[model samples]
Target: MAQNVTRAGKSRTDFRDAIQPFLAPSLREKCATVLAGSVPGLEEIRIRCGRPLMAIGGNGDFFITPQGTISQSPAQAYLPDREDLDRSLQLLGQGSAYALEEQLRSGYITLPGGHRVGLCGKTLVESGRVMRLINISGLNYRLARAIKGLADPITRYIVVGGKPAHTLIVSPPRAGKTTLLRDLVRQFSVGIAELGFPGVKVGLVDERSEVAACYGGVPQMDVGFRTDVLDSCPKAEGILMLIRSMSPQVIATDELGGRKDIEAVEELISAGASLFTTAHGSDPEDLRGRPGLAALMEWKVFERYIFLGRSLGIGTVEKLTDRNLGSLINDKFVLRPRPGSGD
Candidate 1:
């Protein structure tokens, strides 16, 4: 138990170190102080000019006081000023915003450790599209975490005959779909020894830079040796491109929506490559309600469907089903939290 606690502490320290260089002095100190406690489930740190400094954890959202203590009332919280935001942006961009113009145009920047900072403010629009963001007023620092063995229990359902099956993970926001997808990619790419599944080439289309979290064209997370990541590329284009170029046996992507993405999935299937992806929904019915997914469901494109929820815990696997929506598992499976996993 003590060793587990120590491991958790080290994990928190690593998380702090990853973001410290990008924070202003004052904000950094406050964050460090709060992190020194037992906030193991810490997920996001939100900083907004003229608004309360807040930290979101698994329990709920709470404001951080100037003394680095949690507060329920925003009236007693610390408010980040213009200087704080400016200094943070400067540090995040390495003192030059122009160098990160493309990332800013996408409204977020992926940090060195795969942590993401989401930006919000005025937008520069041209030809019916947003060119860039200016006068940034808010920033959401989302911590990146890789839970190494999170996919172990579900590997049997996803891998068949030493190859990946067509699977779609369904979950609401913050239900660990992305984390599960990341681990599945790693396991499939690196081979699961226990299951006697040999590694296969995996093409990861990380559109939001969340799954693989590439930094400077390299994956910051441990995706796997045989995985090839197309960082920050659109899902549709990336899928087809990988089919033509990488010759991957399996293609994994996050959040399947939009007609173009569906069209790309069809192309991937037609090319005989396995597909592993995620979508935002509560259950099979929720997926059927969505137009794009409904079409895919009618075609029986996905062979396995995994549903995740927070009834028991954040990463609980509420149910597993076959292509016809028949129950595959009789009991709910809860993912055990690894020390310092922050899942």
Candidate 2:
């Protein structure tokens, strides 16, 4: 019954009526927190203990609980009823609740709250892949909050033809570029006015689903009416897929680099749709020196590049210099020092 699906051809307006109700008052709070922690001065929250009945999200580098906590190792999740626990264990064995409890004591689980839980004990693997863990440990609960509309400030960068700017956001490790990209996507999907970008089609190539957190194909958060997300697909292939199938006006992806990525963007651009994406780098020299990005950053292909930093995720903007003319327009961060002003 949960909505906010991450399908190729699905539009935001597609499930507006069927999905909103599935958004229990609490789940919405959790989604809000994740966005909040990504940016400063956005929003804040206070959790009341023993309020939410959490579930298991998934098993990643660690076990992620529905509450949003990525666990220390792999944490066990409990059910409300004792019978359920017993039944689960009987059917799933170490994968069951009783077994989970053992793991819980020393186990870690990532909660929907964004906090993580850590666990202890033996590891289970099959053919080099982890099956699960046994013997639980303590659980660490992560809290999630909202940074209300943080991306609202950067809407100007993507406006094209007096419309929303078609932008590509770039940054280095843990620079919060993905978080920024997610928010910007939300703003765009929700529709904007300044550039007549209202209800503009945005195709999200969510290779990891981390951006939208598409749980069981349903987006955990709200994006907008014109958005279509293709979760767990390669960026290059997904771009081409969306371009050919979705008919989106704009294509969006995260952490793009390499010949294929650049080639795909060129394809999208040539097809007349603008692109929004992200990458890793500190400055022009760093970006230009990078193997894959150096070529794309040339400006002839990718028009606008937004660089993100710790303080302001999107700390700077670099215009691609025309390979022929040799100057990137709008390539200034915080506006270059005006003329002859003394500091």
Error of model 1, residue 263, in angstroms: 1.4
Weakest 10 consecutive residues of candidate 1 by summed lDDT: 1-10
Worst ten-residue run, lDDT, model 2? 1-10
lDDT over C-alpha atoms for residue 220 of model 2: 54
Candidate models: Cα lDDT each: 0.87, 0.51
Query: What's the distance in Å from true for residue 92, model 2?
Result: 14
Give the alpha carbon lDDT tens digit for every residue of 96-193 in model 1: 98898998899999998788999998999999999999999999998877777678788888876666899999999999999889988988999877
Those runs of model 1 whose alpha carbons end farther than 4 Å from true positions after fitting are 1-10, 337-343
Candidate 2 lDDT over residue span 217-324, tens digit each = 666555556789997788999999999999988788888877898888878888787777887776567767766777775654555556666442223333333223
Clashes of 2: 62
Regions more than 4 Å wrong, model 2: 1-146, 194-196, 311-343
TM-score of 1: 0.94
* TM values, all candidates: 0.94, 0.54
